[model samples]
Target: MPEFNEKAMHQFNQGLIKEFRENGGKAVSGPFVNAPLLLLTTTGAKSGKPFTTPLVYTKDGDRIVIIASKGGFPTNPAWFHNLKAHPTTTIELGKEKFQAKATITKDPERQRLFDAQAKVMPTFNDYQKATTRQIPVIVLERI
Candidate 1:
């Protein structure tokens, strides 16, 4: 596993968000190649601090969807933890931004949402096969 450097990761991700917003559709994280995504700005579940994570997304009407795969790691991503504590968040899509609510997909419904999203993000299937944990699909509705 890679060492976790909170500061470095924050700087790098913030740069990505700035670029994504400034460059319109021309700029995006490396993850965007296989899936449409947005930056989810959230508050920490424990520390109560703010953080942002780049997440693969799908659109359902006016809502944005994200999955907490952590590349199939055993643990959920920090962003997912944070969003659980603070379900309300911010979504940055290209040059736009909006308030949103982070809702974890539930039970049988999760299967459908997960399959639908996986169609757009085949890498998610790879993530699933890599770990035993259940990857969560977090749906963010515009608020």
Candidate 2:
């Protein structure tokens, strides 16, 4: 497989973000097409600036569940750390955007939410197998 390119990934994410917004939360191109996608806007941990990331998500009750897999990277994604620093964030789903509180799951709930998402997108299972760290499962509840 090709090596990860941070600059390229950022550019691609920008494109995806544009497409998602243009289509009212639907990604018309790339791997996320037809997938459940959301835009998570978190405050940067160190910079204290807003950063928006497009992520795949699953619903748990009225909460939104997301995985910090980062394609099974050894460390958690930047957004995860951002959330740790600032739990209140913004979520853009479908055509609606709202404020939400981010919470990291624990124990059986974490495993269960991970399993539920893996059932929807098997890549999460592979992501878990590829990393040593326990990938974090986060829930976003409307605030």
Candidate 3:
């Protein structure tokens, strides 16, 4: 396995975010092609600036679910911290955009949602094993 490069990952994320926004939230090519993805805009934890991240998501009965897997990195993704500092955020799924509140799922519910998403993208299971810290499963409830 290769070492995780935060700088490279940030650049890649920026490219995907630009593509997703330009193409009406659809990624024309790249790893997320044909995958269910969303653009989450959250306030920076410390900077108070808006930061948008393109993430794979799974729908859960009127809510959007995302994982803080960070590609199995030891630390949770920055967006997760941003959401923690500012729970109210925005999400764009395809051409639809909506306001949402982020909440971290707990316990068995987290595991259940994680499993549901893992079924769709099995790499999530691998992500959990790659890191010791429990990855958070966050629900974006439409506001």
Per-model lDDT:
0.77, 0.95, 0.93
Error of 3 at 24 (Å): 1.9
TM-score per candidate, chains pooled? 0.84, 0.97, 0.96
Instruction: Compose the digit string of candidate 2's lDDT tens values, residues 29-132.
Output: 88999999999999999999999999999999999999999898787889999999999999999999999999999989999999999999999999899889
Arranged by TM-score with the best first, the candidates are 2, 3, 1
Selected candidate, larger lDDT, 1 vs 2: 2
Best by lDDT: 2
For model 3, how does the per-residue alpha-carbon lDDT over 1-143 read when each residue is reduced to its tens digit?
A: 47889799889999998899899888999999999999999999999999988899998998889999998888899999999999999898989999999999998999999999999999999999999999999999999
Candidate 3 colliding pairs, count: 0
lDDT: the better of candidates 1 and 3: 3
**Model 1 Cα displacement at 55 (Å)?**
1.6
| Candidate 2: residue 54 lDDT (0-100) | 98
Compared with the true structure, model 2 gives a TM-score of: 0.97
Query: What is the TM-score of candidate 1?
Result: 0.84
Worst 10 residues of 1 by lDDT: 25-34
Tens digit per residue, CA lDDT, model 1, 23-110:
6733444644434557788998888887877666787767677788877777888898888889999888876888988889897877
